[model samples]
Target: MLLDTFGRQAVDLRVSLTDRCDLRCTYCMPEQGMTWLAKPTLLTDEEVVRLVRIAVTLLGVREVRFTGGEPLLRPGLVGILTACARLQPRPELSLTTNGIGLARTAAALRGAGLDRVNVSLDTLDPRTFQRLSRRDRHHDVLAGLTAARAAGLSPIKVNTVLMRGINDHEAPDLLAWCLERGYELRFIEQMPLDPQHGWDRSTMVTAAEILDRLSTRFTVTPEPAGRRGSAPAERWIVDGGPARVGVIASVTQPFCRACDRTRLTADGQVRNCLFATGETDLRTALREGGDDPRTDARIAELWRAAMWGKKAGGGIGDPDFHQPERPMSAIGG
Candidate 1:
């Protein structure tokens, strides 16, 4: 197993397909928008597939999650999924999308071997959704979720990034709506991925606060993590039905000690930690046109180097330590 210095086994990989996003979420992308990564800088489908195979075979990776500015933006996404499904020890493949253009591609994605999906939905109010996402694709997102359900993506998860004074009031309402629709709801504490994006610690909310408010209405019982490969959300079961709620407290309560994730940027930089400064560039090795053995050596070597960058904790509380320059969108939030 490819265990990092922190004792966290690198079992799941989040692969970014592109740096270009259609929406300009207030917290994620700048109002002027983000600079797109050059086409050549992004990994080709073949390079991505090759990397995944090596990661699963050599590094004990058991799950692979495709993410992006919107992974659906990649024209070769279906082919990528098909390649992932063909890996020797095929990892549990999944994708996280904004669902802007997912309405038509939902069935195609499932047909191409995607195991499940997680859609980003912050508010049920159309106007609020538009303001938060900076796009009027809320209806498309809903349609996409509905289609994903119809296409057999079981236990569909919806990620809601809560911001105080923004969507905090929608928590109870969001909960009721999701439970009624049979969607697993995960409320995430927004992390400071970019200082330029204007993140204020005072405006941030904690997981405990979310639970405290939620419990006043519904009795929440601790639910087991249940599976080996899962996101860093302390699961809970509401009083009624099998409706499960998850809370990801990345900022207020960092999960660095238990972080089991490794991220590969669309530009082929393997990052061991989300808030880490340094990264190992895999593009250089791929561009050299080496044979299989040489290429694999470079890949493994890069993995090891990045693993050395892992910290016991992210030190997110440090007032002096600002986040790395990349925005969450560029890092596949």
Candidate 2:
């Protein structure tokens, strides 16, 4: 186990496939003048699989989630999923995507061993979706969600980010749409991961605000804490039924104490936290070090050392808190 100084073992690994995305979401990156990672800097499909294989088989990682600027944009995603699924322990595999290409690839992804999916869907209104994403493919996303459901992607999770004056009013409506379709909806507080560095805590929505908005329509009940188990989302029973809703209060209610996630950038750097200013270069080790037990242990040791140095929390509320140099796209989800 990659145990941190805080005694939190990293059992969940978030591996990024690429830093390239198809959509130009307003909160994620600028519509133009965005400089993407060079092709040579990206980890090959083989390298990604190798890292995940080691994390699962050697380091006791149980769940592996593929994230990216948009994971569905990776051309070789099916092959990567297939290789990771073949590991001896067979880690639970999932993906976080924007659902642009999922309409065509959902079945293939499921067949290639993807367990479930979490898609970013900020607004249900077509024009709002286009406005938020700067893409006119709102119907494509809905089709993708439907395809994922048909492909047996159990618990199809929808990730919604409510920006101030931009889709903030859709909380109740979003939850209602999700509940009707049986998609577990999770509303996330916008963080300071935008490339433009325009995130303002004063303007961002809060979990309390979301629940208060939701309470106007649905009876939200908090699920017992025991069932949460290091998951970021604080879940709720919607109207006291099987259908559920969640609020990931990352900024307002930080979960650093219970965080079990370790992130891997597409360039093969090990990120101990989302807001980390430092990164451990596992890519150099992977390429320079030979494939052997000694090399494997050395790689694990590097990861352990990275985790050991993790700060107590993301330090969002601190007066001197600094946003990471890399935006969320570069750091994965």
Candidate 3:
């Protein structure tokens, strides 16, 4: 296992297939989408698979997650998943998507060795969905969820960002809908990863607020700490039944002490933390390949060096915190 200076093991790897997304979520990007990286600049399928192989075989990474502006937008996603699944002692493969294009691809993706999925759906209201995403794909997302379940993607996770006075009022409705459908729902606190840098802490909903609202309609009991391991979401049993919900309190309760995840951008930059300001360019080294063993060794060294300096936390609530230049989409949310 690769241990950083803080004694945190790097066991989870998040690979960004592309920086382009189909939806323009207000909290993620501007209404007018930003310019995207050129096709040649993005890592090829072969390069991505090679990096994952090195991480899994060499670095002690046990879980591999595919993320992007929208992972479904990548053309070679299925092939990428197939390649990653072929690894010996296969890492747990999952994806995070906006679900706009998942209806047609969920089955194919599962067939290609995808274990599960996390779909981002903030509101069930059509008008609010359109207003938040700057697009009308609410029906598409619903269809995608149905198709995902039909494809046997067990425990499909739904990610919802609760914004004050925006979708916060619908907490009970969202939880009930997920419980009825048997999907794991997680409410995420809005962070400062937007490209426009307009994140106002006051307008962001805290985990306490989320619990207080949900407790009104359901018996919300806190799950034991560490049940989720290094995972971000903190789980809770809803109404004392099998149904449950989670709150990713990234802002108020930072989980940096147990953070074991590292990120690789679509352009091949390795980031120790999601909000990291510095990046190690692995594309240059990979493209200059000479000996396979030598290049793999160099990549491992770069990954270790990057994680060695990882800060204790994302610092979202710190007084001196500064949002990264890249938006959440670019950072592989």
Q: Kindly list the per-residue Cα lDDT of model 2 for residues 244-298, writing each as its tens digit.
A: 8989999999989999999999999999999999999998888888576577778
Report how far residue 66 has shifted in candidate 1, in Å: 0.6
Residues 1-333, model 1: lDDT tens digits: 667776778898999998887887777876674678889788999888888887898888988999988899999999999989988888998899887877799888888889999999998988998888778888998999999999888768999987788788888888889998989999988888853757877888789888987887888887755542346887778995477899998878776776788899999998887887778888788778556577886787779778866878777888667688777777875
In the range 7-59, model 3's lDDT, one tens digit per residue, is 99989999999988888888998988498988888999999999999999989
Off by over 4 Å in 2: none
Residue clash pairs of candidate 2: none
Task: Show model 1 residue runs off by greater than 4 Å.
Answer: 195-197, 224-230
Clashing pairs in 1: none
Q: Candidates 2 and 3: which is better by lDDT?
A: 2
TM-score of each: 0.95, 0.98, 0.98
What TM-score would candidate 2 get against the native? Answer: 0.98
Question: Cα lDDT of all candidates, in order?
Answer: 0.83, 0.92, 0.91
- Which candidate gets the maximum lDDT versus the true structure? 2
Cα error, residue 180 of model 3, in Å, equals 0.4
Model 1 lDDT-worst window of ten? 222-231
Candidate 2 residue-pair clash tally: 0
